[model samples]
Target chain A: MQPAVSHGDRPRLPIQAILRQTQDLPVLPGAIMRVIQLTGNSDATSRAIADAIGMDQAVTAKVLRLANSSFYGLPRKVTSLQEAVILLGFRTVRLIAMVAGTFTWMTRPLKGYDLPPRQLMRHSMGLALGAQMIARIGQFDPEEAFVAGLLADIGKIAIDNCIDGKISLMMQLGIKGGMTFEDVERTVLGHTHSEIGAHMAENWNLPQEIVEGIRWHHNPLGSGNSWLAHAIHLADVLAMVTGYGLGGDGLQYQLCEESLEICRVSAEDFDGLVEQFVGAVLHGEALLEGMG
Target chain B: MDVRQWNLSFGSQSGGGLSSHQFSVGLAEIRVVNGPTLLECQGIGSCIAVIAYDAHACVSGVAHIILPKRLPSSSSDRPGTFMDTAVEYLLNELVKAGAVAERLKWAYAGGSDFVHLASGASLPALELGRRNSEAAKSELSRLGAEVVGNDTGGTTGRDVSFCTADGDVKVRTVHEGEKTICNLQ
Candidate 1:
């Protein structure tokens, strides 16, 4: 099962050139960007967050719909942006806005990777929910974990946009050549999606931790054993194992054994963790439905 | 067997006199069907799909197995949830469908150790795919069923489609398109 052409013999692009191509990719929506900024600010008020979200009618409608959706299981209807903010809280609302804002692009099919419409979004939501659950268990900030998981594969979008339709060909060659997906990406594209995603996060002004999480999700040890990176890695694997929105890469990514040790999760907990992770994804299906 | 535990959710049903139905066997689920019916396990990673088919009776059963073994404290009643329990339940259902135990042909797929810490990583916890494949083979042998075909122990996820009509099993992967792995007949 050797590749028709040797990987080393294939022409490769420079990382800078690849990044330059991604420059045409859309930036984060203004309202979503503002919400993210305010969410990170210590002195920011719920009113400020609500106003930031309200600035975008589409995002505001989505946030309110999600707040009232069965995903949160609110006792009563959420009538307005302010009311929804008060009920779902700032972080949750911010998450909803971010999800809604990214919904359009995230749901687009990536022919290069063979991802159909909404599949990537489903995977991202699953990863976010799984990461949030693991964060709760590990006593880390669940919100940060959720954000990191949601945007972890964003590099794929950029790469897919940059590489035209050659990604699938590269994937085939790599798999046939017994190379990992990331390895193939690095071989031909000059950098893996993780690295590209990290760069995108940096440009988006995401926190350094989240940037690192995206960078080292495939190799958490590369981040000096960061817990967030490990959590994201585990979440990504769990999403794939549960068969939520799998792409051409499928489950080819590596799961670090030391991630369990770093996150204080044990082998015995695998079944329960999977159950909870699936349950969370199921419960959050309404949120995805609202986006659709 | 609890009737409630028998999950027979159909994915698609074709219209016509001879209706062809497709049943999706999700995580920890087992489904048995007769001719003109297809049972599928999609996007399987780490989890194993243990299939038993009796070509004579045109009956097939699939168990979407997740774990190598069941825990004592585990409250799950789905036999297909664990490799240890899945084989027995799947075999019993096949027998009930008029499949002879000795005549049944077994095929399994989708135990992938794609995600590993490093090359030759030796953590038992991370070897779920290998453990699942081993468990499936051992359990099928214990039941005296003839093991026919398998596509397991790789870093790629697989989608397995089994046609009860002919006992043909097709496996599809991301890199490789769908191909028939075996035909019990």
Candidate 2:
């Protein structure tokens, strides 16, 4: 489908420029980071991870509630972090940390950019889920892919914070400036979100690949075709197209040649990926309907 | 602390590049010239680094480039002027710095071509990282510099530092010992 150009040709806001912001969407809250570390570490134990989860009252509450919630439908109340970890495996436990981390961030509002509190959260969580499907399809570590996809646009949140209400000004500049929003940011802000994110990654001590993925998702070209950068880039766009949670990115869909080539994404596959994602999101949304 | 002699890390196929360090991003002034020595770029992941060291003269140079190719319109970030480009470019810089291409030894670090091989569009093959390695290798061979050592592939991130004044190259991953990417005989 073609991108609809509105009357007056409303200038495109870069739904993507979030990729070029000055820093990472603030580091995962420290507690969440600890959980992520434990989940990713092979030496970490269920008890240890469970202990870590138990530290966050919110997550601890979520685990117990979800385990007993209608979703699991156990005969009796499943008590303790030990039971939750035993039932959920390390992989599932890691996923929980990711969700908890995601919730902590997505719950906030990214004003000046037009994303209502839950709007960006819904979009971010949706992308994260869809990215996992892509990872599974391609046979990589789906969980890690989910994290990559989930945090891909973290840079955008920075732009909203840095520029304030000027997001509208930047949006106007995007189409009129004949710039891909990135040009406008560089022109106004001196650096793009990608650089900011890479900078943020260094500051927050995130793994280089995750930082790279965040920095280059918008312009896969600069990332130099490193598979992690390229795959995550494509996953980001694909998730957007599927309409999982469209954010403030101006809905621009001019695909990058290098990213498409590296992902081997054809017209058919592109459409297929979107359809598959839309379905996946629908399934997840349905299952978690009762909960926020 | 194990006070081993200084070593270095270079690159061929790679995943990431120089992430953690006290060095400045615009810290663009140091250039290697003459001697049997080492060169380095630390905090490397998927990206590849290219090293050219002339052990006989105790001179060396190291470069770290992030991608397989630059964007079509990215004339600003020239591939030939980047990390690997700088490594290969060192030959000319070395000639000026008082060293010959034949006298130089080479090393590489931080490449895992298959780290995320799940994007299965494999016609071009799931070998972006290896292809990068191959590209760097071809360029080095063309320059007549002898490749003395390498640490590429497998899922690991490496930190590399080199000293051209003494012909040393050092590679450090999370748990692995510092191996010299350039162990020129």
Q: Which candidate is the best by lDDT?
A: 1
Cα error, residue A252 of model 2, in Å, equals 3.5
Candidate 2, superposed: residue stretches over 4 Å from native: A1-27, A63-79, A286-291, B1-185
Interface RMSD of each: 6.1, 18.4
For model 2, how does the per-residue alpha-carbon lDDT over B1-185 read when each residue is reduced to its tens digit? 11122221132212223333212111112346453333455434445666666656655555664444433333333333234455556567766776666676777665443222122233333333465567667766766667777776643345566654444556754334356555553
Q: Considering only N, C-alpha and C atoms within 3 Å, which residue pairs clash in candidate 1?
A: A255-B115
lDDT by residue for model 2 over A188-231, one digit each (tens)? Answer: 66656566656655666767777777777666666656555666
After TM-score superposition, what is the CA distance of residue B87 in candidate 2 from its true location, in Å? 61
User: Over 4 Å off in model 1, which ranges?
Assistant: A1-11, A14-26, A161-178, A240-243, A250-254, A267-276, B1-20, B31-35, B52-61, B73-79, B87-106, B141-148, B164-167
Q: How many pairs of residues in model 2 come into backbone collision?
A: 42
Angstrom error of the Cα, residue A259, model 2: value is 3.4
Q: Residue A151 deviation, candidate 1, in Å?
A: 0.4
Models 1 onward score TM values of 0.81, 0.52
